[model samples]
Target: FNPKLRELILAGKTQTLSPKENELLKMLAEHKNDLLPRERALKKIWGSDTYFNGRSMDVYIAKLRKYLKEDSNIEIVNIHGNGFRLVAP
Candidate 1:
């Protein structure tokens, strides 16, 4: 996690992320080993809890998962009907 550059370096490569993605990553990182409620994340990041926005968040989450997949110890688990938890070594 490069706080200054707001970037993530993995597998000896650097990835530049969009502002929304960065914010989402930050939120998950802040929550770390805790559960981040779906509605809460939606409201915080997209300013709404609409179904469309929820779907958008899911896309962003998928992107984050792809970015972090290089590390075997990192995972984003869905807590069906609830939220997500970011687990890291």
Candidate 2:
């Protein structure tokens, strides 16, 4: 894929994402249709796994969902206590 086009597809034309949201989406895109562990997200994005950070990550997840909803092929699914999966198909 073309580098610039890949960035455009990943980032979208709106270009309105918080740093955390951007990182989360980037990770999801990298692992598209695969599980993304909650703990892993916390450690990589929040720098730690704590109650407060967990809630904060949830907020980011919601934001990501809203942003990606325009595309029917894209979905962010919660896997109970396990984590999330970014499904594109």
Candidate 3:
């Protein structure tokens, strides 16, 4: 979690993250392997749990997954109707 530069260092490569992505990543990292509920994450980062905001968050999750793919042990798992869990092995 490189908040200062909005980047993620993985597999010896530096991948930059958007402001929103950084915030989301930071939140997920804080929880690490725990489950972060959809409503909880939405309200924290997006300030609401509206339908559109939910959709936007999903897109951000996809982006994070792609960014961390180079590292086999790092993964963002969706908890179905819940939210996400960042698994760091």
Candidate 4:
């Protein structure tokens, strides 16, 4: 993950990320293997925890999952009504 470039390199391939994508992924990576609270992420990254923003986050999460799909060692676990966990070796 290169925040400067806002891109992710997995399996020798690079996936350029959008601004929100980068921020969300960067936050997740920072908390690698730990829970990143939904409220925290929404507030800090989206500037609000509104329902619409939360839905937007879900979309970003799906995109991130697609980007990381090739790597078996990495997983993004959703904590129901809580947040996300970036599981990686």
In TM-score terms, which candidate is top? 4
lDDT of 1: 0.83
Q: Per-residue lDDT tens digits of candidate 2, residues 1-89?
A: 12233332334545456667777887877778999998887788778435454766888889878767766778899999988999987
TM for every model, in the order presented, reads 0.87, 0.78, 0.89, 0.92
Worst 10 residues of 1 by lDDT: 48-57
C-alpha positional error of residue 88 in candidate 1 after TM-score superposition, expressed in Å: 0.5
lDDT of each: 0.83, 0.73, 0.87, 0.91
Model 2 clash pairs? none
What local lDDT does model 4 show for residue 48? Answer: 49
Q: How far is 35's C-alpha from truth in model 1 (Å)?
A: 0.2
Off by over 4 Å in 3: 48-51
Q: Which 10 residues in a row give candidate 3 its minimum summed lDDT? A: 47-56
Writing each residue's lDDT as its tens digit, candidate 3 over 1-89 gives 68889989988999889888998999899899999787887777778435454667888999999988999899999998888999996
> Which is the winner by TM-score between candidate 2 and candidate 3?
3
Off by over 4 Å in 2: 1-13, 49-52
Top candidate on lDDT is 4
What lDDT tens digits, residue by residue, belong to model 4 across residues 1-89? 89999989999999999998999999999999999999898888878435464777899999999999989889899999889999998
The per-residue C-alpha lDDT of model 2 at residue 46 equals 77
